[model samples]
Target chain A: MIIGQIKDGIVLDHITAGKSPEIYQILCLDKLDCTIATIQNAESLKMGRKDIIKIGKVIDINFDVLGYIDPGITVNVIRDGKLAKRERLTLPERVTDIIKCKNPRCISSVEQELRQEFRLADRERKIYRCIYCDSEAKKQI
Target chain B: MRHLIDIQQLSREDISRLIETALDIIENPGRYSEVCRHKKLATLFFEPSTRTRLSFEAAMYELGGDVLGFSESNSSSAAKGESVSDTARTVGCYADIIAMRHPKEGAPLVASRTAGVPVINAGDGGHNHPTQTLADLLTIYREKGSFNNLTIGCCGDLKFGRTVHSLISAMSRYENVKFVLISPEELKVPKYIKTDVLEANNIPYIESTSLEDNIGKLDILYMTRVQRERFFNEADYLRLKDSYVLTPEKLKAAKADLSVMHPLPRVNEISVAVDDDPRACYFKQVLNGKYMRMALILKLLEVAV
Candidate 1:
């Protein structure tokens, strides 16, 4: 599939297959007034199969959400149809507004304006927990 | 400490030190009477938590400090839709330190961030009850002599009890502490605590629906009331309350040295007859709460400046 190349935007590459929609939905990429294409089961030299999301305009992204969903994902920034920079994500120590605290009594639930935050409790297990209640925070995306 | 939000943040050594400090104050109350003469503790309760709030106020008072603030959400600016951050920032101007108990978890954390002083979480929803856990640790050390190699039976509402959660997390930091989780399947310990705190820490633990089976081997029998507030149905609370009641008959099966503890305001979880039992230490837990609060206030105010 010719998903097209980014001229001046972000290319979210190496997304675990079948997770691009979640990233797209989470980032609200479809609502942006710019060209965005998602190619599923894309050919990869490193990964046997991957998902790629190409945005045709420069826009801000929530890296914490992207990292939480799949830490192995890579991003390449294009400027003037040239690869400006390449970025790879790792699990962050703490993230805000990436995951919701599942515990019913968590402050993030009652205090609507407060950011939903989580911390990587166990890096090996890829376990993130609500910063407030310490409950395990599942990635809805 | 800038914030006493979680018992998990406190090491066994820090707990021991605080317990020792509490004990020291207990022995010679006159020595530290005026330790916090000019200090003030703001008891900001956005929930109806009289016991915890009273314990905090009593602690501040006994330490020669002043106390201030509202007891319920309706009484405060929160009733007028004021945010916790705004209230905390406003309260910070009037009080030197804060002891907050909110129905929402991490409300104290928000206070700690903006309060411009140390914040003690009296009890924040079901997230934590660090002060109560401090009282429990002190009581356990006094009764069991050591936290190591002891079988602690945590009975009742483990799922919703912040005291049980904090106590388990705190005691797990000790050497060779085993947890006998005695509760109905519906009230089993939360998964995160089981997996993250207990399993991850490699602490030995076993779960059983029968409290009597585990009572015989326990060094500490921590009884918690099955809160009516936690149940969606009144019948469920009524049915489950009888399942965990600690009576003299049950105590007969327990070790003679077993320390029976409860965070008070008991809604018939323990038999009133058990109050006379030698193993009963729930009343002492009340006094310990006072002393621990005193120790906490002194520690916070000592470094407040």
Candidate 2:
């Protein structure tokens, strides 16, 4: 399927197959006043299978949350249909208010409107733990 | 100014400083007395807590400070549908600092986020009891004189024991600290504790069901209650309840100088007969708890300004 190349936009390439919609939801592409194209389960030699998202306008994207989702995803910026700059995502050292802690006794469970914060406890295993209780987070990202 | 929601937030230096302060308070009580003369400590215990709630009040009173707040949720505005955030904000206005004990995990964190004053987690659900860990650390430091190079055995209810989890997390930061996780298979220490705190830090540890078999190898034996409340089924609690009772005979295999500690309100886990043994330090552990809370209160209050 040919999603037309963008002149000045961002190409979120190399996303793990079947994970683009979640990213699109998180990035809120539905609310954006620009063209966004998502190609699912596309052929890729590097990843075996991949998903791609093409945004027709330049917008600030949260690299931290993106990296937390899939560290290998590439964000390719295009200017006038030519590659301008390329960036690769990596897991964030910490994520805030994105994941709720599962521990029943965790402080976040009772405190309304508190930022559910998590810090990367183990980089190698991609483990993130609640900042308040240190309980392992249920969030895969 | 920061709230201590978990023992994991404290570093080795922080732990050392707290321990030294506690020791100083132990040695020279009069010198630090009246440090919080004008301050107030609010004990917002949403759940029933006998030792923790009282010692926090005692710690403040001993520091020449006043203590206020309810001992249970029904007495507090929480019964009127007041959220923890609102309670914390309201309490923040009246108290210099707060020590909260709630049945819900992270209730203290919510309070800490909303309160203008510092918040200390006395006990939050079964998630954390840092002051208890502080008490445990002070006991270990006073008895053994160091945090490193020791074999610590934690027995009973490892799965639901917040005290054990916090203790393991705190001790894992020290060098050459090996752990013997003693519990029935059903009550084994949670897998995340082994994988995240132990293996992640490369701390050597062993898990077993029998306490007597590992008694001789330990420098410290931390006992905890096999709480009936933590068990879902009464039959499961009864079956695993008597699995590792520390009897006088068990003490025969333990080192003479072993620092036997327990976060009290124990039920049959440690025999009353074993209390006469020189190794039993649970009572002293209680007293040490007061000193550590005093030290912690002083540190947090002084920094709050």
lDDT per residue for candidate 2 within B203-270, as digits (tens), equals 99999988878999999999888888666699998898888889898789888889899999888889
Clashes of each: 0, 6
State in Å the error of residue B277, model 1.
Answer: 1.9
DockQ of each: 0.72, 0.60
Off by over 4 Å in 1: A1-9, A28-37, A56-58, A79-83, B303-305
Tens-place lDDT per residue, model 1, B168-204, is: 8888888898999999988889988898889988999
TM-score, candidate number 2: 0.91
Q: Which ten residues in a row have the lowest lDDT in candidate 1 chain B?
A: B296-305
Chain A of candidate 1: what's the TM-score?
0.88
In model 1, residue pairs whose N, Cα or C atoms come closer than 3 Å (at least 3 residues apart or on different chains), thus clashing, are none
Error of 1 at B268 (Å): 1.9
